[model samples]
Target: MAETVKKATRESFGEALCELAEQNKDIVVFDADLAAATKTSIFQKANPDRFFDCGIAEGNMMGVAAGMAAAGKIPVAASFAMFATGRAFEQIRNSIAYPKLNVKIAGSHAGISTGEDGATHQCIEDIAIMRAIPNMVVLNPADHWEMKAATKAAIEYNGPVYIRLGRLAIDSFNDPETYSFELGKGITLHEGNDVTVIASGLVVNEALKAVKVLEAEGISARLINIHTIKPIDRDIVIKAAQETGRIITVEEHNVVGGLADAVCEVVTAECPVKVTRIGVQDEFGYSGPAWELLDAFKLTQPHIAQVIRDVVNEK
Candidate 1:
């Protein structure tokens, strides 16, 4: 097998923003003094006139993006997940979501994968907060290709969108040439009848790895990638629950309000099944290496596989 290309989703977001800006001049980008880290600097370099640096004020950046969106420009506000969704949440709720502006909020370095930046920087609750807002569309792309596609889709979409981006470099699983991105839809990567693993963001790759391990042990695991968390693909989730007696949700975020919550809502409403959520428990992350953090939090492939195995074995 050929080696898979690895790239951070933030890098994909920046490159996609630059590419989309070339096609649509209405696209504008705003950063809160962390463009380099968020990779929005790529857009700043390519479109200097359209890029605005809002110092260290993430809230102010969100307000500016809302104002720009009000004026018919597609404004993308980029910042760390903790600051973008945590600090500027009120601005995003009142200024952007209230009026239903076409502002695209990109939160990079999301989840515990933010590594040594530690608990202060790691954001595990952005998904829950963003999804709670009335007019917000939550998107959490899994791989480099998915991020690029989702970025373009968010630009074309005329509403408030919250896109979660990651800092960890992950293997590219989707083929850019063959991949087609649709909003509010889930992609089934593997087919199985026994159990279903619904996952998003960085954990999608881990879910894929766990599938191989389960298959070797005579378990058939279906893998679903939910790129859009809000307006989740309810039909696919309901179908998975109906066909597969057991369901496991894997995410790089907190188990409270991320992918697990979304899947549970669907399963509880439609076809009830035994749903197991694999993610960070309700707690802040600590300072550690990215891979180490994943293991410590039990987000690794073996951990994920074991959870699925237990669910399958449960009578």
Candidate 2:
């Protein structure tokens, strides 16, 4: 395991994809005309023959990737998160998810990080869209370590997988010496009785930071980093809800149909608890820096802490 921490999820994905391509000859890459921007250029430089630049046609690229996967090649397709999930959804559903093709849809510049590109490019509905599709594996890693491990796991897992990558870099959370990745399993960063914060992607790092702030104020906060959004770690969430009377779900996506919604669906049916969601409200994002966008949507650390405090105080 590497000890270095990353600043952005897309960079983490780029580094991990290059490493995977070196180890697996069948691991091929396809970029929809944004290799340099998406950082897949590293893999393209290392394995020229195994890399394909499919221009800006994400839909066509998806169909081609499905074809390649059907031919026994492990195709990892890259594109803007918006186009990958928004424009190419039908192909992803019928061609990839339906047949359960061995394709890894590694989308970069997800969420509000495609800053300045505005709402037209930001993928706020990606998680909800991807997770709703049957037979598709959805992953939203918290940091660099989880990204690398999840990348490897997605490559080995036998099915169509959608791994969301953010443009904003996040600090490494797990201790390299001990932490190991597990698919569909949740990791509890802190054990608390007052509240539990279930988060994914860069927001997980933020929630962990908020937990420290909460601890200083005498609030014991439990942090659950949900790396897999599709096969969500419902057991861990239900257990947390059972123990912690209040729960706060956080993410870099819309509050509806994403991690928060998923957790609520599980907890409300299995073990009802006080739940508050911290994320982009149901709306499109505008052009701005990533942090500004997060702040605008109330997905910041302080906002999460405030939500936790409010939810805990309620009833």
Return the TM-score for each candidate structure.
0.98, 0.97
Candidate 1 per-residue lDDT, tens place, 140-198, comes to: 99998999999999999999999999999999888876788999999999899889999
Task: Give, for candidate 2, the lowest lDDT window spanning 10 residues.
Answer: 1-10
Instruction: Name the top lDDT candidate.
Output: 1
Error of 1 at 41 (Å): 0.5
Reference-based lDDT, each prediction: 0.94, 0.88
Residue 55 in candidate 1, Cα distance off native in Å? 0.7
- Going through the candidates in order, what is the number of backbone clashes in each? 0, 3
Report lDDT (Cα) of residue 307, candidate 1.
Answer: 91
TM-score between model 2 and native? 0.97
Best TM-score among the predictions, by candidate number:
1
Q: What local lDDT does model 2 show for residue 309? A: 77
lDDT of 2 at 216: 91
Each candidate: RMSD: 1.1, 1.4
Candidate 1: lDDT over CA atoms? 0.94
